[model samples]
Target chain A: MTNQQCGTSRIAGCQFTLHPMSDNFVDIILSALDEVDSTKVWKDTDDVTTCVRGKMVHVFDVTKAIFLHAAKTGEHVAMSGTFSIGCPGDNEADVYMAESDEPMNLEKSQTIDQQAGCKFSLYPLGREDYMDKIYEQIDLSKARGVEVSASHYMTRLDGDVKDIFNAIEESFVAVQEKVSHTTMTFTISANSPSNK
Target chain B: MTNQQCGTSRIAGCQFTLHPMSDNFVDIILSALDEVDSTKVWKDTDDVTTCVRGKMVHVFDVTKAIFLHAAKTGEHVAMSGTFSIGCPGDNEADVYMAESDEPMNLEKSQTIDQQAGCKFSLYPLGREDYMDKIYEQIDLSKARGVEVSASHYMTRLDGDVKDIFNAIEESFVAVQEKVSHTTMTFTISANSPSNK
Candidate 1:
C-alpha cells in the first residue's frame, strides 16, 4: 500500500515506546508530542508502542522535544525505540537518499551537531542477495555524509542524531524494497541537550 | 580497573538513559526503580544517563520493573541502553556459562519459560581469527541449550533471556580472553511476566 505520501518522504522511521514513571505519565507524553512540529511525521500508538514514520528531521525533533519536556520534571522515565531506514513496504521511498536534496530545514540541520550513535543489524533471513542489498543501503548512507563503522554483523553510525537517523532510514528503506522478511534492530543513543 | 566485586557477578550488564516527555520524569523513573528488588544492581546517575551494573537477574529485573512502572503511567518515556556481556578485564569470568551450574535462582529459573530471545553480533574489528572465535561461541551457546539462528553478520538466539545472556557472556568472555577488543550488541526481549 504505497501512498503518494511516500514520495515526499526521504528517511525511514522509528517505532518507540515511552514508559513514563509518573502517575500522570500518559498526559505528559501526549502533550509533549502535541507541542512539536510534526508536519512530515506519521504517528500511531497502540498498547505496546507508538510508531512514528517520516523524514529524519521531524522524528528527531519530536524525540528531542519529548525528552526535553519529560526530563524537565526531573522524574524518572524511559524510552525504547527501534529506528530503521528501510524495510519492505515503505511508503516514502528514497526521498532523503536522492542525489540532490532540498534543505528540509537549513538552520536545524546546520547547528544540530550533538552526536547520536547507534548499532544496528539488518536480517534478510536467508535471502541469497541480502549482502548486495545491505551494501546498497550502506552506500546510500555514505552518500548522505553519514559515517559508518562496519563490523562482522552490525554497523555503528556516529554523527548528528538527525543525520544518523536519516542515514538509518535511508539505508533501511533502500533494502526494504528488495527483501520481504528483513528485520532491522537498532540500539540508539544521543547526547541529551538538556543534560549537556 | 577490575575490582574484587566482579567475582560475585554472574551476568554482564548495561547502562541506560531514559528520556521522558514530562517535567516530573525523574521522579517517575527513580520511583519505579525504587519499587523493584534492586539489591545488587549498582546505580549511578549524572545529568546525562544512569548506569547499572550487576548480575544479569538483578539488572533485568530492575529494567523490567522500571519499564512496567513507567509504562503504567501511560505517558511516553524512552530508554537507551548498552548491554554488554564481556569486555577487556571482566572479572566475572565464566560463572554463568559454566557447563554445570548452581541455579542462581532456582524458583525464578524454574518458572521462566524457554523462549527468551536475543539477536546479537560480535564485532571483532580487524581480528584475524574472528570467524573461528564466532563459531566457538556459537558452539558454546548451543551446548547451553540456546537455539541459535545464524546469519552473515549476526546470530539470533531463542531461549531464556537468562540463558541467552549467559550464552552472550560466555561467548564474549571467551573471545575477550584471546583478543584485546571485541564488542557485542544485542536486541533482547522476553515474555513479560507482569504484562501477562
Candidate 2:
C-alpha cells in the first residue's frame, strides 16, 4: 500500500477491463472484484476499467481470481489487461525488478511452478515481409537462450523474466527499421499459477 | 483532443508501455511518440506509461507509427497495451462501440483487409484437469460459429470482432465453476496492417 511496504520489493501493476458477453457485466465485475485480496494489492475502478497494483504474486492472484469469478456467470466474459514491471521511476512497479541478480531456476520451471509467461503479436504496417522480420527476431531470441513458440498470428515466449524480455526486444528491433508503422501488444505476469 | 470532438464518435483508449530491449529506450520512445498525430489523437505520458485517446483508426495509426519509429533502433521493443471501445459511461471509449448497429463485413475480412485478430492463453491455477476445462470452453465457442486453434499451452481464436469476443467469453466461462484459479492474457486490434 505504501512505498515503505513495497520498498525495494518487486511490485507489478495491471490495468484491466472485463467484458461480459451476455450482459450482467456490472454484476459479474462487482462480484468478482469482491474476492480480490485487498491486503495484498490495490484496486481502482471506473465505469470502463479496473487497475490493480501490488506485489507480483498478489497481482496475478487477484487478477486470476476476479477473472474466474466473473466467468462463473457463464456470460462469455473476456478480461483484457496490460501488465508491467521493471519500469524505471515507477515506484510501485519496482519490487519485481529490483533484485534482478537472482537467476531463474529453469530446471524446476513448469506449469505448476510459480512462474510466468507472455503471449504477444507484432503488427508491421504496410510490409509484406513481416514474418521474415519476426523470424529474425525469433532467431535472435533463440541465440539468447529463450524459448519461443511461433504461430501464424503471434509469438509465445516463456522463461526467465530477463531472457524472455531480451528476446522480445531482439525480435521487435528486427523489423522496426523498414516500416514506420508497427504495433505490438503483449500480456505479461510476474508469477503465473500455471502454464495454460 | 476535446470532449466535443469525441462526441458520438466511436473512439477508443489504450494505455501502453514500450519496453525497448536495449538501453536507448528513451530515444526510441521519444522518436516514436513524436511521429504520432496530435491533431487526431490525444497522447499523454507520465513517468510510467503513455495513454492514447481518439478514434479507433487514429489510435491504431498513432500506435503503429510510434512502434515502428521506436523499432528503427533495431532494439527489441515490446509494447503492452490495454485497449477498449464499448464501456458504459466511458464517453471517450464509447465512440468505437456507440454505432454497434453496423454489421461487420465478414466476407471481406482477411489478413490484409484492415482487419485485426488476437491470441491469448488461459492459465488455470491449481488444477490438474485444466485442459478438460479448456476443452469445455472451446466446445462452447465452437457452438457459437467461431474458429479456434488450440495448442498444448494456449488457445487461438480468430473471426469477426463480435464472434471472437463471443468465443472468448464462452470459453472463459466454461471453466469458471471449478475450484481452480485461472488467468487469461490476450492481444487484439480492429485493423492490422501485416501479420507477424
Candidate 3:
C-alpha cells in the first residue's frame, strides 16, 4: 500500500495531511511506552510526564540544514513535524514531518508497572543510515528522555488542536535551533471528524 | 535535455539544484510574466524574485501537487521528472525525503517588453483568484498558481531569514483558526546556500 508511502519526498517546502486520533494516538503511545518500561519510566503516571494530545494538521518546510538535522536525528520522540512555508507561498500548508532521536520507549519499566512516560515512537525511514547521530545524542537523564528503538510509527495528535499547535511550535524550535540550516513550517487545521 | 524543461515536470520535497546559462531564470520569468497580461506578476524585479540559476534545493513539499496541478492546468513548462530518497543508514536516512509542493515561477523574459499598465502578461492562476468571493468557499487556486504554473522557476523575497520566517508565520493564520484540529506548529531554520 503505497498510499502516502509512494509520494515523492522533498528536502525543502513540503505538505501532508494529519488525522487526530486522541485516544488513538495516546493508545499507541501508551502501548509503546508500556513496552519499554514500567514504574521507573513513569513516576506516579502523572509525574512521569505531562501529556496533552489533540488533533491537528501540521505543516513544515525543512531547509537543507534542517533536513540534514532531521536526517541526522531520525527517531526523536519529541521532534515536531509541522509543515510551514518560507517567504513565498499561496498559503501555509497543514502538514508535519519529523525524525526522532531515540527509541521512544520507557527506559526503566521494571518497577513502573504499566505506567509509561508519554513518548511517541516514530521513525519512518525508507532509506538506511539516513539519520543516526540524532539517535546517538539521546540523554536519559533529561526531563523528556526519548528512546530510539521499540515501536516507531507516525503517531499524531488527538484532542486539543490548540495544544497540538503549541507543540508544533515547540517542535519547530528544536528543528530550528537544535537542528541547523533546516527551515520547517506548519499549519494546523480546525477540529473536524475527518482529521482523526 | 531533460533539464531544459520544467514545464510539465514536477518535483516533491527534494531540494533541486539549478544554474543559469545564457538563459537565467530571470529571462525565463520575464518572458512568462509578460505573457500573463492580467495582473502585476513582478511586484519588484530586483527584490521580489529569487533566481535559481545554479543548483538549489526545494525545501517545500509540493512536487506531486505541482506536477498534478500543472498537468491538470496544462501550464507546466520545464522538463518533468521525479526524485526518490536513497537509504543512508540501517534504520535512518541521510537525505531528507521531500514531499514538498512544486516551486513557482512567474516566467520572465529577457527579450520581451512588458505591456503598458500590465504587471503580468500571463498568469496561470493568481492572488486575485485566490481571494475571489465564490472561490473562497473552495480553492482551485493551488492547482492554478505557483504549485502548478509560472515559468520563471522562482518567486521573490524582500527580507532575509527573518523575513521568510515571518512570512511563514503570517501564512499560518488561516490554518490555525479555521481548522480547529491540533494546534499548528512551525520549526524554522535559515534556508541559505552557505549553510547547506
Candidate 4:
C-alpha cells in the first residue's frame, strides 16, 4: 500500500517495510523509543574494544537476555551467540570484506534454507550510504565463519517473537526519520506449533 | 564511570562513552541521525551495476546522494564523477568504502579531519571496535570495500553534534546492559583547533 519499492535483498521468507512515506511511522517512532534511566561511560581504550568485541552494546545485551527470557518462560532450546570484528578505522586505499569466511556445506549460492531461515539482503531504498558500515560488520562476522560472528553492538535483545520484532521495528523507526532511505530483509524461524 | 574490561581493536580518532553509567541515548540518537530521504530505490540490477561496479548492495540513489552531500558540504570542487568502487546498493556482499580520489592526502597515515563532531565511535572508549571495522572495510573496500562505509548498516553513525556528548553518556548505559562484556577508548582529534 505504500509508495516505497520492495528490495530484492530480502530476508528469505519474511516481508518487511522498505521506505514507507506514511505518516503513521513518525508517530510510532516517537513513541517507540525508550528512556535512558542511567548512563555508563567507558573510561579506557581497553574497555571500548572489549565491550564492542565482547557483545557489549545494550541491544546485544537485550538479545542475549531475550534468549534467557525464552528459557525462563519455559520454551524449547534458547540459542545465542556473539559476533566480533576488528577494524583499523581508515583506508588510504584498497577494499576488503570485513568477514570473508565461506560457509561450508553450501549446496548452492543464495538458496534459502527454510529450516534455518536463510536470509538475503533486505536493503531498502535511500539507504545506500550506510550499507558499507553495517554489512562490514556482517563481513566481520562471516570472516569468523560459523565459529564466530560480528556486528551486534547495542543490538542484543529478546522477548516473545513479537516483542523481538518490535525491538527490530523500533530500531528501524528509531533511525528512519534521519535517514532518507532504508530497506531491510528479515528471516524469522517458523515457530513450532508445540511451543504455543 | 563504570568498571568495564579491555577491547579487541583500535583505529584513528576513536570516540566512545566515557562513563559506563551515563544517561538517555534514544533522544540523542533521534536527534543525531542524518537522514537520506526522498529518493527512488534503484531496482534494475543492470542499472544498479552501471551506477557502482563489481559486487555491491546497489543503491544508486544513496550513492549519488552521498556524493551530493560531499559536494554540497565538503571543500572539494568539480563534481561529476563515478564512484571509485561503484554506486550504492550493488547487491555486493560487503560494505564498501569508495576510494577517496582526493583521499585525506597524507604521505603517511595522517588522521581523518575531525572538524565535524558527533562521531561516537571516534570517542576514546569506542575507538578500538570502531577502528577494527574501519580498517577491515579499508582492506576490503574494492571487491568488498563497498560494504564498509558510513552508509552501511554496520557502521555507527556520526549523528548530530548538537547536544550529543551528553547522549554518549546514555549510549554506554544501554550498551553495558545489552552486551555481555565491554571496554572503551577515547581520543582528541590531533587536528582539532583545540589541539592546534
Chain A vs. true chain A, TM-score per model, equals: 0.53, 0.48, 0.26, 0.26
Q: Model 2, which residues run further than 4 Å from truth? A: A1-9, A92-153, A156-196, B1-196
- C-alpha displacement of B179 in model 4, angstroms? 31
Report the C-alpha lDDT of model 3 over B88-134, residue by residue, as the tens digit: 21122212223222233213211222110000001111122221221
User: Which lDDT value does model 2 have at B63?
Assistant: 55
The fnat score for candidate 1 comes to 0.07
Q: What is the lDDT of residue A60 in candidate 3?
A: 19
Alpha-carbon RMSD of each model: 10.8, 21.8, 21.9, 20.7
Superior candidate under lDDT, 2 versus 4:
2
Superposition TM-score, candidate 4 onto the true structure: 0.21
| Residues A127-170, model 4: lDDT tens digits | 32343334332321212112211111222222234344334444
**Ranking by lDDT, best first?**
1, 2, 4, 3
Greater-TM-score candidate between 1 and 3: 1
Off by over 4 Å in 3: A1-155, A185-187, A192-195, B1-84, B87-196
DockQ of each: 0.08, 0.02, 0.02, 0.02
Better candidate number, 3 or 4, judged by TM-score:
3
Write one digit per residue (lDDT tens) for candidate 4, span B1-196. 0111112221001111110011221222122123333122221111001122221122223332332233233221111111111112123322232322232212111222222222122111222243233333222222211111231122222322212222333333333333222222111111111211
Interface RMSD of 4: 21.0
Instruction: Please state the CAPRI-style docking class of candidate 1.
Output: incorrect
Each candidate structure's TM-score, on Cα atoms with residue i matched to residue i, is: 0.43, 0.32, 0.22, 0.21
How do the residues A112-186 of candidate 3 rate in per-residue lDDT, one tens digit apiece? 211111112112122122133224332222323222122111122322322333343344434333332222222
